[model samples]
Target: MGRQSIKFKRLTPFFNRQRLEQQFSFQLTATPKAIDKRFIYSGQVTERQIHKRYGVIVSESSETDDYVLDDSFLIWQGQQGLVIITGCSHSGIDAIIRHAKKITGNDKIQAIVGGLHLRCASLAALKERKSNRSPC
Candidate 1:
């Protein structure tokens, strides 16, 4: 298989709701933006680096340290590269897969599981067949 991408759940209507949480309505001809001004997508996280929740690192584009993670892989022994799981990826599943490959230094995706979050995904299934090329 080539690579896989899928979404696990549907986001609330207010998922994309943008509110002025902070006060930064200053003048800006060409000023830099902060992370809070963006929508962070924590794709289908499956691990728990801490001791609470099983993470589902979603991919996102931000100026902050890291609002989202492109890699949802779990390092078992070496590297499995099982699937590129994500949920409602605002940054796009394609972009997320690309980042995973780059970060893992591998082009093989085992499987994909999660929501693509495409405008038309509501009327379709995002499950895809991999090309049988897993990271070595």
Candidate 2:
């Protein structure tokens, strides 16, 4: 066997404005990585119905359930029901599901994908994981 040189291809940023508009009108974007702030993209995807749903809330909670108010979600409506895609679900899954069904008028949850933050799992459940029945 002989050693060989590998060649790599340079990739360029490609954009077709017409094609993109046909699919999804660009929604609000938050580029900042800070937990305390959010910034929207300054592109021309001006649809009033979309932009009204996004922003930041600065209030804090006295309860232990307090979490970031910037937790947003993406809901897709299909023939069966709504498919919810969320980040850390700080507002709770039940609340999110309820809101989705109310907004879309679909009670059936076709699918839910993302972290549901089960920080309150019971001690027995945790112990079960230590047993052979459940692997780490």
Candidate 3:
């Protein structure tokens, strides 16, 4: 057998419009499988000096639940209310949204996108979401 060279494709940075607002992404990837979900709505932190400045909260899921914090973030467009985004939400997306609203007091949801991850939950899975109001 001869040795082989491994070639990998180069990745590119995603394109995003430049904005002066706080943004972040949180991902939890290991846990036990018994604990139920939880929401941590820590309000809009627009302060530029210290580092706890962010505009959303997410459920800190436990290992026993067989669940993890997928990908969750807060979307804020200046004067608009907070619109939370989720990725493959094993943690309740509804819980995230409610926490964000309660924290920011911004009732109008601008939009919601990405995977629902319910596998076939239909109504019971995503009734708390803002629904198909996407301009996409």
Candidate 4:
């Protein structure tokens, strides 16, 4: 058997900005809340510098040497407890959990689903994580 090379082309390259904007409507608020306050945004996150990454680009020339501050998680109040759903957790899992607890005033966490992004963590980093008790 022989290997074969394949090439792909993008069909849709441009978007209809005006039409899309007219079709969809959105509301932007400092405190994003939904579903009768059962679900809410974690807002700005303050993370520990243990696993921080730098050199993130905000614009063409501007960059940040700190972990992402805009990273957020979705907190859903379930029947049993609150479920924290995150995407990458770039801000830090501990910070997200703490924010969720603080905003909702609920310390009971039923489950945490989605990316923790700890695949490339070192042994010492994992040990440090273990030493710090989870807020959940």
Candidate 2 stretches greater than 4 Å from native: 1-66, 123-136
**Residues 18-71, model 3: lDDT tens digits:** 332236444332321212223232332222112221223333452122223333
Error of 2 at 74 (Å): 0.5
Tens-digit lDDT string for candidate 2 (30-92): 321212222211122122212222323333442222234445666766666667776766665
> By the TM-score metric, which is better: model 1 or model 3?
3
Query: How far does residue 109 in candidate 4 sit from its true spot (Å)?
Result: 0.8
Stretches of model 1 off by over 4 angstroms after superposition? 1-80, 118-136
Give the clashing residue pairs of candidate 3, or none.
31-63, 32-63, 32-64, 32-65, 33-63, 33-64, 33-65, 33-66, 34-64, 34-65
Candidate 1 residue 44 C-alpha distance from true site, Å: 13
For 22-83, candidate 4 gives per-residue lDDT tens digits of 87875544454664657876666554433555434454565455556567778889888899
Comparing 1 with 2 on lDDT, the higher-scoring candidate is 2
> Relative to the unseen true structure, what is the C-alpha lDDT of residue 42 in candidate 3, on a scale of 0 to 100?
32
TM-score of each: 0.32, 0.42, 0.37, 0.66
Displacement of the residue 5 alpha carbon in candidate 3, Å? 33
Runs with alpha carbons beyond 4 Å of true place in candidate 4: 1-20, 46-54, 58-66, 122-135
* Top candidate by lDDT: 4
Q: Write the per-residue lDDT of candidate 1 for residues 65-122, one digit (tens) a residue.
A: 3334333322111244435556545444555566555544557666656764444643
Clashing pairs in 4: none
What is the TM-score ranking, best to worst? 4, 2, 3, 1
